[model samples]
Target: MTATAPDQDIALAGILRAQHGVISWRQARRRLTGSAVNHRVVSGRWQRVHLGVYLAYPGQVTRIQRWWIASLAVGNGRPALLAGLTALRLHGLRLPEAAEPVHLLLPAHRTDRDPPPGVVVHRTRRLSRADARLDMSPPCTTAARSMVDAAQWAFDDTTAVSIVAATFQQRLVVLDQVRTVLGTSRRLRRRPVIESAVADAGGGSESAYEIEFLRLCRLAGLPRPSRQSVRRDRSGRRRYRDVYFDPWRVQVEIDGSQHMETRGWYADMRSGNEIAISGVRLLRFPGWAVRHRPGEVIADVRAALEAAGWHGPSLSAGSGSATASHDGRVPHRTRPILPG
Candidate 1:
């Protein structure tokens, strides 16, 4: 049942339009001769972007087009899904840095010895249909799997934490989805790191600000505060505190741009007044302060904790201390809280 020339032309046009003006040599050959493909490239109507991928139109390529080209080139005749940081970016997660060498996941039975430039091929035996959806135009992993994979492939622990935090903050993926993907993944590298980061994100520190604040508290030697602690105002209305040092009666609030709203601002003011009347000292830090001026914020928090009668060991300026690392990494320690 071969289609007529008019039908083939219509199908090819549809594919070109849907794939952002990109097509593979093998696909083009299905509708066109080898000479026709070469003639289009030679005439500047198509540009060879990868070994077997060509742009149908000679115009600026978009990020998605680049991803599509990479996938098609590596795919060859097997399954190759965009993954890791690349997939996360596709799902709209703001990464600290752009992911170079686009990550592509291929099945174990398949291999790409000559991946196109700026593409990194990852071989996995467990790339099941459940883990990826081919219906997507660019064809990538599920949001959950992409987030977890990005976290595992992060450059450092901090970056990994940030990736998970951003994914949750953006609401691109849910915690349960991440957990399910991890449970199903067979060879997930750095499983514990990914789990810890995702746990922290789900445990109320979902934003970059909250994650940075958590790290700051750890590095500053402050007692771990209850995250998103529940409380009731005088009218019996429920409210949640970002971080609460129960023993010291200190409340730390991380304010993002959303708090700039008139209603939100008023609510915060009311909450602060109530908290102050209840003898709870509130320390508020803008998201920028938490991320950019952490040292100053930590110092202020330390002073507030001390003023609130916290008499635990103070942060010392030496090796293994918060000040020494300066990277916001707190050394693990076990110290019982003593009576002030």
Candidate 2:
């Protein structure tokens, strides 16, 4: 049956909308002729985003648009999955910092070719259909695969572990899934570090903040504190603290921006009041302290623990520690915080 031009336009619009305003030349050719495609490009109605991909709109290109173009540029015979930090970001996993290079994973059979500008193509022989998600817009790698890939591609161990921790804390992907993906990836760098970070997440460390706090404790020679410890308030309501030194009757609360929200703030206040009434010394540290200023965080925590009847050995906050350096740059330890 012959279709009217208007019907074809509508069909094209649907395709464009489905692919986030980007389409492949082959897909466009199914409904548009070479001359018609060239005419649209010349008229500025469509812009060539990649060698064989076009932007259906003239407006500013978007992240999703670039992703679609990268995926489609691989051609039909092979699949190119948006991968690494890019895929993890799309899956709602926030990174410690901005990532770049618009990573794409192409099947090994696709060959190692130069990717379009601003795009980095990775050829992987291990990528299977199960590892890729075809349902997502711009079809990217699955969350587990993307996370593993992101961690492997990360420049540092902290960034890599943070990716694992953030994804697990957000419940975007489970530990078993990450393990499965890691198991399949035999030669991933920093494998032990990734495994340890995943184990920390499994142990109830909700975020990278909690993991850093634990590391600080270990490096400072402080007694290991129970994590996500449950304590009952005066009203019998149970509350969980991020880390608790039961012997010293001390509880450490790791506060992030989420705690600043009205509801979170009030809830924290209530928890703090209850813990205070229960005669427990509470120490609160901003999440940033644990991440960026670990040396200071350890010093403060050490003082707080000592003040809370912890007669343990004095901690040596020296340089080359696992947590952080105690160089002159770090602020000196302040007086121990008293019970509130």
Candidate 3:
């Protein structure tokens, strides 16, 4: 039987009205009954988000859903973070159509008698000061830690690279921060490769692959090229390139998985035609070479530049992996163009 309004349960009405008539049954039960309050929940008046979680308002896009989950998880002795894809959404990294399953992380010692419903909880062993980060809300692992974690379990390399590049471009973390986090966790395997690339990839850098490719080129002693160089052609519009060797009139274009999309392909074709006819030697490098085999990438780049009438020493005194190993920071030193 429905627990109809009792003779003098005005407290329930007061609390409900106080919450703008949008309190949940769980909250109502806590205040009304000494042990457990009983009531029938209305369908339109109260929509069930999860099994026991309800939203009282008719059609409110409530931010309270996440908080409600957090409160419940915290009660279980594990202050959970609305992490992974969920955190990415909150940080405005993922677009609307790209939304995925919400990922949560909690300590292994959650004391709840039963696990929280509607959440996939990963029990992490520890969260360090570096790892612990604050973004849109509660403390979660910093973007660098999250990126390293994601890079390991990503369904695809493209996804991992995208997230990592974004974290760096957004200024959430840097190469050194990632390195330190990796050193502390010892969980991420490819820290050396990714951290090394972060230095070259700065703001406006398209992808992690692009960053690493540029880094390898720099270390290989190629003249540091201008990033995203824009020049107007006869059409009187802007044409951008990944890297531009101005004196050599060569433009290197790094294409990743995303560029394989229909629109990207179309744009690439158009830009390629335009730049090609403009007398710019267009060199394209696939993402795999940039991420995995940088030595090979450097070799190909040197070849392309040389073919583009660039006559320079194949091996420079400063050209080697040992150059970046000295100190992993983006060099602000003036890049002098060699005599062509």
Candidate 4:
């Protein structure tokens, strides 16, 4: 039996609500006459976002609305779930470059070319039901699958690793989930690099800076330091150190850009004072210094470790014993520092 007009109105409203006010021409044609759809667009009540996708509102499209438009525009009678960095953002994994050019995943059989501008479509044979969260509005890949996709599609190795690390740090997904996804995605790009990053993240390297610091230690031949080690401050509050040489009583803090903020700066100063009062030698380096000035970071860390009773091999700057590669990578070192 044909549905009544009120029922069609209710269905259309529900779709617009769930899709963030975006709809496809194919969907609109089912609920209303072609003249009705065209009248809304002509009267400025709706805007065409793509060839067949329309926004119910006339104002600027939000980021999330853009996601909906991307999915609906390219769906083309098939699944088109958001994946890669775009899905990672929806999973609450914040990053500097997590905006624009919505990434989408389509079935391997999809041969449709010419996706709308500012949309990237990736075809995969392994987009199983387990990999996608169909229940979500503007459906996206699962967090673990999204992380894998984001890492696989990242512009560079560092970015790939950073995405994985941030996912773990944000508690968006578990190590086992990521490993399970990787286990099934056998032919993924940068698989080894993603695995190494996952290992580091699982070992408690909560940020990319900490991961880089661990690499520097291995490059300089320094004894591995525990990462994100927990200890009580003077007032008996639990404090986590970025890197700690437990035996030598030396601690190194890697300050990210957030440390420049007033509150973060004060909090860090307090943490430093606590470390000093606890009789641990404290050394601090900004995130940039770790990436751009690894040699200096290595020299200072080596000196502090030596002074605190580490008799490791000298990695002095003058002797040229240990140095980072020109590309700012530590060669032949992929071991992760376990937490204490």
Tell me, by lDDT, which candidate is best: 4
lDDT of 2 by residue, 1-340 (tens): 9778898889988988888888888888878889999999999989987777789889888878777777777644133688988888888776555547888887777763446778788778798878988888877899999988888888897788788888888888876777778778877777766776776776778877887677567656678788887877777777788998888888899998989899999988888887888888888888887777777777777788878767665434454334345451233232221111
Candidate 3 lDDT, tens digit per residue, 197-307?
A: 444454346667776666566556688788777799787987677788898888888887778999999988888898889887887877876766556666667788888
**RMSD in Å for model 1:** 6.0
Model 4: CA > 4 A from native: 77-79, 97-99, 261-263, 311-329, 332-340
Question: Clashing residue pairs in candidate 1, if any?
Answer: none
Instruction: For candidate 2, give the lDDT.
Output: 0.77
* Tens digits of per-residue lDDT for model 4, 109-153: 876555788888888888898998998877999999999898989
Q: List the residue pairs that clash in candidate 2.
A: none
Query: What total of clashing residue pairs does each candidate reach?
Result: 0, 0, 0, 0
Per-model TM-score, in order, reads 0.75, 0.76, 0.59, 0.88
Q: Candidate 2 vs. truth: CA RMSD?
A: 6.8
Query: Which RMSD values do the candidates have, in order?
Result: 6.0, 6.8, 8.6, 3.4
lDDT of 4: 0.84
TM-score of model 4 vs. true structure: 0.88
Sort by TM-score, top down from the best: 4, 2, 1, 3
Please give the distance, in angstroms, between residue 239's alpha carbon in candidate 4 and its true position after superposition: 1.5
Q: What is the model-wide C-alpha lDDT for candidate 3?
A: 0.59
- Model 2 lDDT at residue 331: 30
Residue 318 lDDT in model 3? 53
